[model samples]
Target: MRSVEKVGKTVNDAVTEALIELGASTEEVDIEIITKGSKGLLGFGARDAKVRVTLKAPAEVEPQIEVISEVKEDVKVANANKETETVAPPKSSKVKNKEKKDSEDAVVVTRDELAHVQALAEEFLYKLLREMNIEATVKSEVVNNNRLSIGFEGKSMGVVIGKRGETLDAIQYIVNIVANKGRTEYVKIMLDTENYRARREETLKKLAYKLSKKAQQSKKPIILEPMNPYDRRIIHSALQDSKIVKTHSEGKEPFRRVVITPNYQNKSYR
Candidate 1:
């Protein structure tokens, strides 16, 4: 039996590393924790967690042959000088078009479908806020197509908005799930309080313009801080008309960011 010590930011990470290195399953190894690492401030003097893994000893086995009944066989020709034919199934254009429509319906939400979903969403949110002891008037935006944008206006809306609109985002997430439930297609839902979304969009647009100018003037790329998908879309939309700059998103969720670069106007873009 061989043992290996691995270090990582956590005991689980260390165990993962050890398993990968030894190419063993969890059931095949015994793990020992060395240290529970500390998440130190600002990445200074951080102690990583450690684990020791030992491979389990193999069990001794006795080999025995089990007998299967044998039968005499009449041998047949093995496709020697034989001709084979495959018949193709008849194809219907209508069937293919119906399948394509089904797939598209699953992915694309229609305006009428969103209207119904948004109505349910608004009722759900109004009830939710009332239950929370925060009496708010919830209304759906009338202008949007294939998307639900709910507007909340209340006498006391500060608690609903929370710090940096975190609560609002949480509420929006729940309401989005409510809106899309039992639907075959996606219906995006957005919640706004005190026009927070519009304000946020304006801020992102300004930041995009500023960064675009900076990148163009300095001939360097600028990476913005990670934002949610909606905010990232706002940044891209803001820069869509920029003749001198372009935007791209990189990294994974929660840590994904927007990178801005100067376009130099000589290159064509879509």
Candidate 2:
């Protein structure tokens, strides 16, 4: 889906674009502002905001098929690029230079739109934390993967992260739900404190691989301690196709963890 958050006017340009493409009137589409913009510090911290919209129409009366076709074309292009990278070798200087140029060219951005998204995320994050009786300042920025990176600062950031960041993950999930409620476009939100989440994810991946090896050698199940949902998801995803071991998540939210078991039936834990 395409997104627009540019400045110069308080209007729904994206809705107009969607309506034009859908061959439908504005009334046929449903529009909602998922988040509000922010203005801070005497116009120095002023930026635009965003809204997510969804359009509905009768099955036979939908928009032109070209839109969907374009999305498919994009998917094909991405897959083709992936295959080329894996099969092609960087043997020639020309190839290497081209690859570097391509990488540099990939970062497409409209500065106004980016600033708007960051403002919206920061505003929503601050309000959410405040309602939870936690005093914190939420600041966000657009990062890779069309994701928003939110950072919490203040004396209570430690409280926000909680033990092993289980509470912090819950906070992030709530922020995502609240932020995306009644929205059409999907925006990924990542919350962290001092880069703790990234560091922890790397650590968990290492631990998952290490445990998989141990299970392979001992032919036994390795049950890990309870972890937050995100960490458990990481472990499960990391060992998805491990030939020597299988991974599964056990327990409920806030206490879930991944268990690695040998491929063959051996010692079991109940």
Model 2 spans > 4 angstroms off: 1-117, 128-137, 241-243, 250-257, 264-270
- Whose lDDT is greatest here? 1
lDDT of 2: 0.58
- Once fitted onto the true fold, the runs of candidate 1 whose alpha carbons sit more than 4 angstroms away are 1-119, 141-146, 264-270
**Clashing residue pairs for model 2:** none
What's the count of clashing pairs in each model shown? Answer: 0, 0
lDDT of 1 by residue, 132-250 (tens): 89988888874335566678888778788764466899998888888788876667777888987787677767767766775675554565555667777877767765667666665
Alpha-carbon local distance difference test for all models:
0.66, 0.58
Error of 2 at 101 (Å): 22
Candidate 2's residue-wise lDDT over 4-97, tens digit each?
3322112343343333333333333455665455665787876544555455544432343344345335436645655211111224434755
